[model samples]
Target: MNTQDAAIPSLDSDLADGAITPIDRPTLHSVVVSRLRDMIIEGVLLPGTRINEGQLGQQLGVSRTPLREALKVLAMEGLVELVPGRGAMVCVLTAKDVRDMLEVLSSLEHLAGTLTCQNASDAQIGAVRTLHDEMLAFYRSGDRLQYFKKNQQIHSALIVLAGNASLAMVHDILQSKMRRIRYLGDQNDDTWSGAVADHEEMIAALEARDGPRLSAALVDHLTRTWDRVKDAI
Candidate 1:
């Protein structure tokens, strides 16, 4: 067998060894997409790097079909570029791209803040506050990943509370592209502290049901977030 073929452990062997059980094709496809997405967001597939389909497929123990489909989904999410002749490359965001996305995201968060104030149930707001507190705990414990995950949950909860599916959809699309950059920003002590403080303001605004204050705070928070990452872009 070729080196590449030898390198790929058989799925059947995994099942025989009780390492993994059989799963439906759809489930397998979803797993492939998620794995690829995580790799991209974690910078395993570095920005502007050309995608090596053969190596990637072998490493993933997945066929080209599922890998290709995952690439298509990532392309739609603006994480990958499909070059006609050269195949796929990881998308690199320019400074202008970051600014443009942040601009639109700022507007979306502003609208979300307004709607969340007017429409969110007390329970929903409470949930966000709980998440915010949990995120703070993680931050204090120096668990950056868990803190960021909870931070994202707080933001998503606000979007869900906004009662607009279209708005949530657009925000999710833009947010995906910024995930890595935002994670990097969270590594900086000053920026991370500022972000935590911003969340405190957000929770306060929500508790008060102050739509205008929440809206303004979101815009300012997002603007400052961009400021933290702009130099890196």
Candidate 2:
């Protein structure tokens, strides 16, 4: 063989026989969509990157049918853009989108906390307290992921305590949009400490059942969080 030809290695000889195993194919469209969504949120798929169906399907060990369905769901969530001839691309979030989402979420969360102060059940308050304790534990352990889950529980519990279906639905959707950003913020050392303190303060207000105080605190907390991320987002 020529020197150039000898320099190239063949794939079949790169490893022991059967060194690699194929991944399991996804059975449901939602599962496929969720896997892709996770990759996008976790930074595996960066913003504005084109998704090649054939290549992505091969990478994911999925067929075009399932990959297409997954792309459709991502498009609905504003995470993927559908181009007429180019297929899907990861969405690039703009400042405007961030601002609008912050406004909506802040208002709804503030209102939800206010209503919770007035109408929350004893059991609901207890549940929130439990979640608060869990968050404290997670924080102490430096497990930001667990802390994040507890944070969601606390927020969702407050919304449920509000007893407004429409408001809860709105808050839930807003939460979905901002979760990844919030998670990253919580992982930062300085941000995490301050965030823990804010949670404690909010819990105290909830325990006191003070609607106005809770409402104001909720608004301020959410606003500050968004402010921290404003420049980057």
Candidate 3:
């Protein structure tokens, strides 16, 4: 066998050892979008990086059609900007951009707090608690990526529980816009710990179903987010 072939682990051996498992693959567009998003968030493709479609398509083993489609989706989410001549560029946030979005997001979440405390079923609240537990588990295991995803999910779940489609939609856009900065900000151990403490307070207030208290906590969390992530931008 050639050296490349020799290095390949045998599928039969993996199957025999129960090390192989079947998994459903995501759609082409979804996979491309996810990979591109990760690359941007991890700084593999830094902010203001102009996307070279042809080269990127080759690297991703995809065609221009799917790549373009994925870029369109990302643009809508505010993670990438579509330029007239430049194709696509990763979105760059100034400190001012971060501040503006976080301010708006804080107000939205503050509103969501009252609505959620009033409208959410016990089951809905419990679902967020479950996500919090899972997030904490990921944090304990030092799985930062999974923890970050779960953390976002918990916030989104609260917005969802508010039972307002508009709030959820806007929150999603803002969350996507800030994803990379938030991930980078938490790189500090002290900042990450403070964030966890903030979440603990949030969940506690939520479980108590105290509208004012929950709103206070949500506002505090979102407002303090600026401090946690300001240096990252």
Could you give me the TM-score of model 3 versus the true structure?
Answer: 0.86
Please give the clash total of every predicted structure, in order: 0, 0, 0
What tens-digit string does per-residue lDDT give for candidate 2 at 1-233? 99999997765765555655667886678788878877876667877899989998999888999899889877876678899988899887677877788889888988887899989988889889999998999999988766887888888888989999999988877776666566656747888888888888899999999888888888887877876667556
Name the 10 consecutive residues with the lowest summed lDDT in model 3. 182-191
Report the Cα lDDT for residue 49, model 2.
93
Q: Which stretches of model 3 miss by more than 4 angstroms? A: 1-25
Per residue, candidate 1 scores C-alpha lDDT tens digits across 1-233 of: 99999999998898899999666566877898788877876678889999999899999999899999999999998888999999999999888888899999999999999999999998888888889889999999988877877888888888889999999999999887887677777767889999998989989999999999998888998899887887777
Model 3: how far is 32 from its true place, Å? 1.2
- lDDT value, candidate 2, whole model: 0.82
List CA RMSD, all candidates: 11.5, 15.2, 9.6
Point out the higher-scoring one by TM-score: 1 or 3: 3
- Give per-residue lDDT, candidate 2, residue 219: 83
- Order of models, best TM-score first: 3, 1, 2
Candidate 2 collision pairs = none
Give stretches of model 2 more than 4 Å off: 1-34
